[model samples]
Target: MAIVEVIVPQLGEGLQEVRVTRFLKQPGDRVERDEHIYEMETDKANVEVESPYAGVIVEWLAKEGDILPIGAPIARMEVEGVVEAASPVSHAPQSAPTPSAPAAPPREPVGVGARLELIIPPRTRAYARQKGISEEELRRIPAASGNKLMPEDIDAYLAGRSETAATAEYVDYPLPQQQRAFIYRIKRSSQLVVPAVLRRPARWDAVRRVVEQFKSTPNAPVHPSEFQVFAYCAAQATLQHPKFRSQLVGEDTLRQYPHVNLGIAVARPGDELVTALVKNASALDFVSFVRTLQSQIRKARAGEDQADASIQLLLTYMGGYQMVDAIPVLVAPAVAILFAGEAFPVEGVPHVNLVLTFDHRLINGVGGAEFLNAVAQNLENAETLVQSGMAG
Candidate 1:
C-alpha cells in the first residue's frame, strides 16, 4: 500500500483558488478512481472534483469553508501502488518557449509576483473586478487581517471613497456585502425585465387535508404544509408550461431549462431574507421533493445557501399571516415568482389568493393566468400530488 497526496487541481479560466463547499467522502471511506471526493465553490459555479486514483481516505488537510489555492494538498489517501517521489505542484501557467523580443516597460511599479505576497481570496478578486477595481487600486486598500484581504475590507474602502467624494449636503452609509448584493439584484431586475402581476384564487381545502394526513403519518421524513404542496405543484406544472422554466439569456434570446429549479424565499431572524433552492425539483418524487425542500430551508436559515440566481422560479409564502395578497418583486434570471397568502373561508369554502409576479417580456398576461390556473388546479387535487408512499 502507498499513501498518495490529493491536491486541488487546476480549475481553469484564471481561477487561482476555490472554497471547499462539501466533502463527499470522509476519512476511512474507500473511493474509486475518477470518483467525486469533494465539492468546491468557485466564482463561476459549484464544481464536484474527481479523484485521480482509487484509494481509501486517510486524513483531510482542509475542512469545509477553507479557501485554498490550486495545487494545495487537500487530503491523503492509501492506495495499492509503488509511489514515486512527486514533484512540487506549480500554480503558475506553463508556457511554451518563444523567441526573445524587446521587453515592454512595466505599466505599474509593483509586479504581479509582488502582489501575490498578500493573500487575496478568489471571491474577493471577483468582487473587485465587478467594481472595476484595478490591481493598483487593490494594492492601495489595506487588508483587515494579517496579509489576507476580505470582501468586507473592499466594501469599507468603496464606502469611504464614496463618502469622501460626496458633497457635505448628503451623507453616505456603507452597506454590508450581503445587503449590497441583494440591492444590486433588485436594481438589476428592475432595469432588465418588464414585470407584471397576476392573482388567482386557489382552493386550499384539499391541500389542508393532505397536510393533516401527513401529520398522522409516523416518523415522516419531512412535515408537509400547504406552502410546500403549492411549491411542488408549481414545479410540476412547469412540465407543461415551459415558459415558467425559461430565462432571458441576452437581449433577444429565451433559454428554457429542462428541469425546474425552485427557489423558496426564507426569512431568517433579524429580517434577513435568503432563497433556499431545490434544484431539479420536477425530476424528484413528492417525498423526495419535500425532504430536499426542508433540508435546503435549514441550510438557508443557517446562512449556507443565499439567493442563487440559477433558480428558475421563486415562491414566497405568507401563510398563517393576516395578509391576503402581495405583489412580489420579480427577481431577474427567474421570470416567474409566486406569492401565497393567508387562506380564508369564502362562501363556506376555504380558498387562498396566489399572486404570480411574472416578467411580461417572456410571458403575456394570458399565459401567466393560464399557468397560475394550472397550479391552482394542482392544489385542488392535492391528494394525487402527495402520493400514498410519502410515509414510506
Candidate 2:
C-alpha cells in the first residue's frame, strides 16, 4: 500500500491559515473521495475540508483547535496507484462539529498564582494573554455553558466583572454559520464605524388604519406586514434622501447604489438572526413589496443565504418588544440602518418609536435626523403608500 499525505487545501484568497475544529473519521476508517474528513475555521468563516481519495486514514497530523497554514499536511492515508484529485476547497463555512470527549475533572481551587492549561481557540488564549488574565481568574468566571470555554464567554465574563457582578452566568452558544457573518459585521461596525443615532416617536394610527382598510376591502391590495409597511416607508424615504442608498468608499466620496436593496433582519427560531433582501424596494409599490417580502421569508426558511452582504440599506423591527426604540449599529460601507420598536396605544393614538443610525463618516447628524423623519412621515401617510396597485 502506498501511503500518501493529505494536506490542508487553500480555502480562499487572503485566508492563509485555519483552526482544525473537528475530525470526522478515525485513523483506521476508510474515507471516500469528496467526503468531508475534517472541518477548519478561519477568523471570519468555518469550512469543511474533504478527502480527495478513497483510502484508509493512516494518522491525523492535526488536532482540534490547532492552527495550520494552507498546504500543510493534515493527515496520512494509504491508497492505491493513480491517486485522484488531491485538493479541493470549499470557501463557505460548513459544519464539522467534533463529538465531545469525556470532560476533565473540575480542578480544586489552587493558590492565587496557579497556572491552568485549558483547551480553547487561539483567539481566546491570545485575548487572555493580551489582557494579562490568568487561568485562575477564568475559573472564577461562571458560565451556563458546556465543557469548552469560548472567546465570547471570556469576553462576557470580562464585561460582567467590570460591573462587579458577583455571581454571573453567560450563555455560550455554538456558532452557526449564518450567525458568524452577522457577528463579524457587528463587531466590525463597532470598531471603526463612527455612528450617529436619531430616535423619533411615529404615530402608527394611520398605519393600522391602512392595514385594516386593506383587509376589509374586497379585491384590495395584498395586506402587508407591519415590517413590510416599515420597509416601504424606509424605501420611499430613501428616494427623498439618496444618502441612505450610498456607501462611503473614499475619503470625500460616497458611492450610491443604482438600486435600493433593503435588508430585513429577521430573528428566526433558536434566537438566530438572518437577513433577507428586498431588492429595489423603493421601486416596488405596496402590493409588489408585500409579495417580495413573503418571498424573502420563504427563501430564508429554505436555508438559502438570506443575508445579502451587499444590501444597500437595512430595516429591522421589534414589534412585540416593550422598548420605545433602539440605536442600531451602522454596518460599514452602508451609510445607515433603521429600527422600529413595538407600537403602543396612548390616548387612542398608536405610537411606535423609530430610530435611524448612520455612519458619521459620510452622513452628518442633521442628515440622519431628516432621513428618519422622512421615514416616519411616509408611514404616517400609510394611505399614500398602499393606495396604488402595480406600484413597481
Candidate 3:
C-alpha cells in the first residue's frame, strides 16, 4: 500500500509557522481527496488544510495546540487497497434494503485546495441555533469558506436577506477561539506600537442637546445621538486640521486623506471589536450625517461592517459603561484614536472626558496635544456651529 504524507501548506507572506487549532479527521479515519483535515492558526487568521489523497489515516504527527513550521509533514495515510487494519465481521445478513427504512442522503463531497470554511465557535453556533437559523443556510454563504469565515461576513449575509424568513431568526455568534487569538495578537501589537498620551475632560453640553433634539423629534429624518454628534464634530475638526486626519505611511511621510473617514468603534457582545467607517463625514449635513452614522452603527453592532477605509482618526465612546477615562490603542495605519467616556456632573455642569492616544513615532507630544485641543474646542461650541452649518 502506498503511504501519502500530508504537509502543512503555505498560508501567506510573512507567515512561517502556525498552531494546529483543530483536527477534523482522526487517525484510522477514512478521508477522501480534498476533504478538510485540520485547522491551523496564523497571526492574521486561521486556515484549514484539505487532504491531498483518498486514504485511511495511518498516523497523526501533529497534535492540537502544537506549533509547526510550513512544509512540515503533519500526517500520513495509507492509500486505497491497503489492509493495514482488519475489518469487523458483521452478524446480520447483507440485505439490499428494508421497506420501512429509507436510505440516508449522500454526504456532500469535500472540495480540494484549501477552501474557506466559516469556523463558528460553539457559543456562536448555539446562539444562532437558539435564534432558529439553520446551520445549513449559514454554511451556504458565498464567502463562508477557507479556514474560517469572519463574523462580519455572516452578519452581512443575514442583513442582506433580512426580508427573508431566515433573517428574522438571526442571532450573533461568538468568534472562534482562533479568531480571538488573532484579536489578542492585534491588541498586543497595538499596545506595543501606540502610546497613551493624556486623558482630558470633554465638554458634552452641545452633543447632549443634539441627541435630545433628535430623540424628541421622532419624525425627523435623522435620529441624532451623542455618538453621531461626536462623529460629526470629529469629522469637522479633522477637516479643519488636516494633520489630525492624516495617516503615518512611514517615518518621515504622512498621507492626508482628502475626505474625512471617521471610524466609530463598536464592541460586540463578545470580546471582539469592529469599527464602522463613516465615509466623507465632511460632506454630509447634521441630519444626513446622523442617519448615516446610525446605519453604520447598526450594521457594526450586527457584525456586518468590514473593509477598512482611508480612516483619518478613530472615535470610541464607552460612556454607557460609566467609564470615566481610557487610553485607547490606535488602529494601525491611522495616527490617532479619540476615546470619550461617560458624561458626569462636574461642578454642577455636565461633562465627558476625552482621552487621545496617538502614535508617538509619527506625531510629537505637542502635535498630539494640539489635536486634542482642537477636538475639545469643536465639541465645546458644537451646538452653535452645527446649527449654523445646517442653516447655511
| Candidate with the greatest TM-score versus the true structure | 1
Q: Top model by lDDT, which number? A: 1
lDDT of 1 by residue, 244-326 (tens): 98887666888888988898888867677778999988888888998889889899888764566577899999987788889
Error of 1 at 129 (Å): 20
Clashing pairs in 3: 115-146, 116-145, 116-146, 117-145, 117-146, 118-149, 124-173, 124-174
Query: How big is the positional error of residue 45 in model 2, measured in Å on the Cα after superposition?
Result: 14
Worst 10 residues of 3 by lDDT: 82-91
Where is model 2 more than 4 Å wrong at Cα?
1-173, 250-252, 388-392
User: What is the alpha-carbon lDDT for the whole of candidate 2?
Assistant: 0.71
| Alpha-carbon local distance difference test for all models | 0.77, 0.71, 0.68
Worst 10 residues of 1 by lDDT: 108-117
The TM-score of predicted model 3 comes to: 0.57
The parts of candidate 1 lying over 4 Å away from their true place are 1-174, 219-221, 388-392
Against the true structure, candidate 1 reaches a TM-score of 0.60
Ranking by lDDT: 1, 2, 3
